[model samples]
Target: MKRRALLSSLAAGSVAALAGCNERGNATTGTTTHDDSTRTTTPTTSDAPTPPDTGLADATTAVFETRDRTISLLGGRRRLPSGLVMRAWLSATATADHPARVTATLTNDTEYETTLRLDEVPPFDTTPHASPGRDYDHTLYLAPTERHGFATTVPAVARAESGGWYLDGPPDRWQPEAVELAPGETLVGEFAVVPERPDSFPPGRYAFGYTDDPLTLSAWQSSQPGPTEESAFEDATPPAFAEQSPAWYHDATPETQAFLRPSAERVDAPAAVEFTLHNHRTEPLSGNVYDWTLYKQVEDDWYHIAPWAIPVPLTPLAPGDTHTWTFHAFSGPSVECENAVALGHLGGGRYAFHVNMSSESGPTHAALFDIDAPAVSVTPTEDVSVEREYRLVRASTPDDGGDRATLVVQRTDDADTRLLPEQVMRPRNRGLRNTLPFFEDGVQKVRLRTTDGVVDDALHGGEPERVFRYDGNAFAAWRA
Candidate 1:
């Protein structure tokens, strides 16, 4: 399937709510100010003043509370050179009698396609962004003066534990990664700032910012000091893919599958491509002037497929800039049988995927990548009663192992288990639980037997799809 076709569904579901902002109400005699960056509050006559409107009226100030609530610290939008619009706002919330909580949201306006970088940490990280984690490590407070040392002391916040393969080794060692957004795509990320501790938040103006803790700053600085002159995309010319690169291929081996099969789930569509984009020019470049088109090489001919484009705007790059681009054939695990039909994943051999780029001025292209596959032995299960093989692709368990595979459960008298090439099986991701509930409880070695009745395909009544029963289980027969 073409990249564009593969990502079309994502585009359809990317709408984000931009309301609930700029809500206004009376402060009940509390202080109200109109400063661009300052919040307004009026002292209530009663020590137990009535709660002000929870709906924040302005970008800055709101009623102070020991409980958790979202307070706007700042709000604004930036228009980039690529015609993409960027919106950012800071909000504060805290649990009851807990330390104040703060978060920044950076959104891509729904008007155009754009890309946003999410991999940077503070000081060097972009504004209107919150760090990732269960608890934020930095404290946010207003200071009597600016530059009280952007330095911060790392708090006693424990490092969060996680499962799965993280490309940058540890969470602290993460590198920058970018997301392509369809029009109106909104991403909200939260981090722990001024954790719920006694000294986490000191008396101050309490604007939307983290503490200048030295330890915290040091760790983030070492990890991501922002995109440096050497890191920005630098290419004064057209962008092209590198030569002889296998953009998409199966990285799993038999041993890895054996180790992962019992422990992790697999994804229906597991095709992945890793290739570098090289800028062949002498000047820095930005913007999406080139149109991307994907193709599959069948036999000797190159067939066209749609390309996946980020609905968001692109950032500028420096000359001679080259960066790796990882593309997944499917956005997530395929949950239905029809997804296979859409992907056209039958009869596989040396099929290769190529990404081609074109511009109104001219065509500049490269072979994005390709994959070679072994033939799948499509045959009936052993039992004479149940004819069709239940060769469903498994959704990947993203937590432990980072790859996907299809567990070929051969139901013949001498039941056999084999790990087939994932793509050969269609994306049937109707939640693995629905198809293989036993998978969650651990693999069940139940016997397969043919049932007496036959049924029509769910969609096409005339078509033949087989249904079988497990000798050990008492549920209705399953369709294959």
Candidate 2:
């Protein structure tokens, strides 16, 4: 369903599609002009029935945006230092017509991992990146205070990914990390710029950026901003263990099952993936590297990923207490896939996730069902006559609540009633409906039952019923 166009004409504007820009230097000055008469026109004349004003290509929006900014570096420095890349854009915006997109891309022009510094001259809050939300699988953090820190939060980016978490706190907060970046490889993210409008702010123009309209950076970048910056991050060094090689644990220590298996829907893997492992034993497990051998169930070949191998120093495990750790792996060529991850780890220990598939000699690692119970609900009736809206209600009684419960739906119909089916709901979701038609309504009896899976404290489910009244008239009229 879309609006149709009546006339055909080219919109006026430079038809030149903007090619992406590179790190500009003093070496290049004027706009490089292409040959004349060769410029192209968009929405060119077509014979196969013209397209509507809106198409998938034309529909876009801004999810992230910022106001504009401009700054004066200490010595009038226009270009950032080597191993650095910077992009300044104006305004935060959204809602199609006010579209904004972050196009800051990493330039692998450096030999090793590097950091893109973020510093504001004065008075305004500084943002070092234009696109940090492009990748949807992970979480993004902002530095609170210091402006200049190199490296990406992701470690493998080698100087590009800064992942260490730091709180600069209100007015000036930030986070930084280090990654091993390689040449010619680029990591990209995106954002949008937008303005703020609240019931309290009147019709006056509210500036979106610091000092200048769009964004600008100048001060201190020139002679290198004075060294007032000191990362809240204390030690820049990694733990001694992370520097050592990895060892594969392949012995039987009798891992006892604490609970039933997790639900199939909650289970992440059949084999290569185990939710998380706890240190049930008394001794501490220490290792510099962790190597995991994953396999594709269908392919029968080994898959590889850098599993998190960490160290637990001479710390003793108090009987009845435990420590937990998780491992994640992604896809590969013939049988490969990658997934996004969430969850943060406190640093001080060496943490790395590398993917390397190789042959191994050992007994297979297996999983036992520590299953979780299923959740459900039962309802009596979903529909009622317009006359009964005040009396009839959808009702359900869970197994546990049955003894402690009373009438869920008030007395209404006397002729016939159809009970509703139960459904499973995940975290944060609600109001899901079932489309099964009511079975010949009048008044019918429905009941609920359960088992250990239904009674577990960790599981959720219920059973409910309804009475159908021919004249009680207490339900909402079906909106045909």
Residues 285-386, candidate 2, lDDT per residue (tens digit)? 222113322111112211211222334333321211222223322111112224423221111111222222111231222222211222223212233211
Best by lDDT: 1
- What is the TM-score (0 to 1) of candidate 1? 0.23
Whole-model lDDT, model 1 = 0.27
Candidate 1 regions off by >4 Å? 1-129, 133-144, 147-285, 289-291, 297-303, 307-342, 346-480
Tell me each candidate's TM-score: 0.23, 0.18
As a whole number from 0 to 100, the lDDT of residue 448 in candidate 2 is 18
**lDDT (0-100) at residue 77 of candidate 2?**
13
RMSD of each: 22.2, 25.9
Q: Per-residue alpha-carbon lDDT of model 1 for 311-372, expressed as tens digits?
A: 44443322223334344544333224431212333233323333232222323323323333
Model 2 misplaced stretches (Cα beyond 4 Å): 1-79, 88-93, 96-99, 115-180, 195-214, 217-480
- The numbered model that scores best in TM-score is 1
Each model's backbone clash number: 51, 93
